[model samples]
Target: MPQIFFLSRPWDDRDVTWKFRRRPAPAEPDTLGGHVRVDSRTKNLTKRLSAGDVAVIDHEDIDRVSAEALVACQPAAVLNAAKSTSGRYPNMGPGILLDAGIPLIDDLGSQIMDLHEGDVVRVDESGAVHRGNDLIAEGEWQTDELNSAKMEEARSGISVQLSAFAHNTMSYLEREQDLILNSVGIPSVRTDFDDRQVLIVVRGYHYKDDLQSLRSYIRDYRPVLVGVDGGADAILELGMRPDVIVGDMDSVSDEALNSGAEVIVHAYRDGSAPGVKRVEELGVPYIVFPMTGTSEDAAMILADSKGAKLIVAVGTHSSLIEFLDKGREGMASTFLTRLKVGGRLIDAKGASQLYQSRISSWQLVALVLAGVLAMAAALTTTEVGQTALGLAQAWFLDIGNWFTNLFR
Candidate 1:
């Protein structure tokens, strides 16, 4: 049987589609070549693949995870859904697979009629390839060096860019997050922070209700809002502004920087810097912490040092898959960082356990007003008024149905 894996989300767009789905039963056919679906954003999707797993990567998701996943899969071959190797859109998957001894099969998703597992097939890398023992020629051999070179060039561009981002930006943060978490000794700071506690927002992991659950707590506890790198953006999404934004400054958007948050630029040990310039250009106050780890780690450390009684973390990674996505060893750094956190380092996952229900009384008042307006419009004789009523009714009905379905 060909084992097939399906990627749940695209690589570049991790922010919107990072939610975990309940595992579903596999329906794909078993082939001699195993089919694996890897998320474009999954850091180690390709790196963790075993031999014989054919990785199906989205042609659009040209990032390190996709490249690494393709390498890790070590598949019999790769199938490009996009087909064309040239265009504005990126196709990093095909090139990586080809370089790693995997055959590049373009448009296999549309061309193949049917295929099964364990089928004896001869790949004609010398010319056009054939699937199974049938020796059927599905495509022509490429003679153009330029077209092939385009593939290599595309792959190289993506690899270099992602490697730089990961090494300089992401990896730095990961290391820093570890250092603070692992650093032993609970030293209290003399700084009088405005808040009683602090909220840390991480980009990935289970944070669906993290912000929502903490809404009341933010008001009651008066926690200093802190965002780690892109976690700053996540903080804004929750209708909260961060007091401090920590990271190497690659993934964060300009809107995040302009949100009146103080920036803390994570610098290298030897005094080399990138984020300092950006923060200065934005006229944001920033302090450089030259460390070997992630900004999240630094945030925790800063919070502890600054006299925070409790540190609440939201959307933080706490699983094997997540750690592997980082392409790191065990969470030794995270373990150590936690030791340095005195008082409480509460994981947001635990906070999600409790729930409080409340009625939106304002919604009822709005509905009644809307009904009166609709009734008033129904009595109008003008064509424009009738059209407006019809549109309003349709919109209300659609919204009502949507809400009703949610309950059902």
Candidate 2:
């Protein structure tokens, strides 16, 4: 008989111990077990998560994208040092985790961030965090009911969010007017894009799908591939090498940095480039592009200034909610960057959907068949074909006469 065990909730003020008995296994919930993996940056944290491990993160108001990444990791449980849903916006992260059957401990306190990586921790039904026999932190366990209530409340505040987003956009425009109107501080890159298509990929929403869809375009045109930070890893995932990798260098993996791609570290107008240190540590050759916009924006400007005939952007945030989710105070530079690249710029989705392969396997086969049939018909219409047919008929007649004579 299988042994049965019941893992009680930590948030419950009850002392529960695991008892093993030889009998038919009971339908009891299993306790979460594994080394606790902690990171303040949720994006970086997701890269390290493995199945059955508990994730301790300090992300507040976790957005849908971050939540999806966490869910993909299939963690045993998630303990947030900050609120999972701050009611600031209708963030779908917490709800997604709950729906995926992953326990989410909401706002255990900032001290939870101090939990070293690989520390063994347990979470109970009531969402109490425990280290060995001592309870270290406690938080509310997010459930369907609570998440729904918070989402409803957040929905009601959309008007306020819109107003704030508009204000921020205007503020961004004011600060990044130069990036929008003219190319300024665009760095020289070894990769030439003169009269060629340039593909700028960011590890944003649906980037993988967009990249997959553009496989044919990539193969045919062989566009200059530019990856923004973690996007470099995405390019590598598809078995393609990046021509240039640009970003702050935090979320990108070391493997991508050493992939022989020309590294361009994006820096502020004040000449501070944090990613430069990582690049130096790796001893990879790199250049610094000091500009007043996001890495994605800088990539577009660089491609445009380099005389790229067309620019295709993948996973670049465009919607109001996407910008809000990015937690940027202003999108002014992005707006201006778009304007600067105006006619040349195209969204990945638009390009993929619009692009039709000039020739498909079936089409090629049909064309070959058509050519064969057309040649046969043309040959049959000529005197040579008639003479050949006559000769074939005479040969068959001679064969028939010979067989008849032999039988007789």
Candidate 3:
């Protein structure tokens, strides 16, 4: 029988004087036992991951967002067939995993992909991987020192990446000139935006903070809410329903899809929409908007084309580093799209900071009641107010006596 080890707290307690003890060494290798879960796309992999799972992925230079998602699942270990950091751009994914005390095995090669899901696998102290008594693969353990060296090397190549990014941007601009020059290919949807404020939410850096800050604005203006991909879930999380959900459909959950919001599946310029399949399976009605740019760009353009008076963005990328962190190769469509939208576009942070909270009806009523009480108290305490009150009481008594005499 194979010995099973559960690493509920793999590095919690350490023996300080284990070397001082004289004992026979165990013959078996130190190992972890778990079911194998594999996916080439890190994003898709995270959705299926559970605790104690051995995540087998083929992500090269995994980005921060993907790493964060994986870490949230609390896996037993991460086995990667590709280099976690390819020295491309000081990617933060590998460093984040290692810092979280999760074991990262790198460069296990393509053969690991052959392993089926739920197959029992064990990784030994020597970084060798085994599948049911058969030695399948071996990889280098990612240590802090090795990760640091790769990050430094990646940092050195930032300039080259920037140049390539610029080239890609120019190419995209030339290809999608119509989007910048004029309003074209705006898809029709049920949600109306004519002469209304539109709030387009994207799941990006600091999105939650920005959204929270805009609570007053959202309550006041009641803007037409548009969620791009996972942003629909964000909107739902805040107890607001999205008027329209636009995305490729991979990241958005089924609950958001079934949220009774008008769904628009983003497609390539060639009219292939991958998200429609899931929507169809859910028995929900949806339409396709085939475009080349991102779902965010598509959403903004749609709002503008529908005669929106103002467009506010929450959690949208505004800086170059943000774009790089999202692993976007080019922002040409985004830049041009903003230019087309022009004066209508507003960042949520700026709007939230500028907006002043308005007093509610209950607060106004309380203020009025407090004012009346203060006036009554002042009248009772002041000499002049007391005299005036006594005279008013005398006048009332005299009127009552006159009425009684007339009746008699």
Q: Which candidate is the best by TM-score?
A: 2
Cα RMSD to the true fold for all candidates: 16.9, 11.6, 12.2
Q: List, residue by residue over 259-365, the lDDT tens digit for candidate 2.
A: 99999999987889999999899999999998776888888888998899999999887765566666665454576678778999988743444455788899999
lDDT of 1 by residue, 1-408 (tens): 322233343333222122211223223312233444343333334445557654443343333335444554556555443343543223433333333334454443433323333333443543333554564334322222433576556545655544443455445446455445454332233335534678888764435456777788888877788888877877788887887788788767788989988777777666566998888887876677766555666677777766677888986655423432344332334444566674578878535545545558898899999998877866586787788878989999999999999999
- Return whichever of 1 and 2 wins on lDDT: 2
| Candidate numbers sorted by TM-score from highest down | 2, 3, 1
CA RMSD (A), model 3: 12.2
lDDT of 2 at 388: 86
Model 3: CA > 4 A from native: 1-31, 208-213, 328-332, 348-408
The TM-score values for the models, in the order shown, are: 0.46, 0.76, 0.73
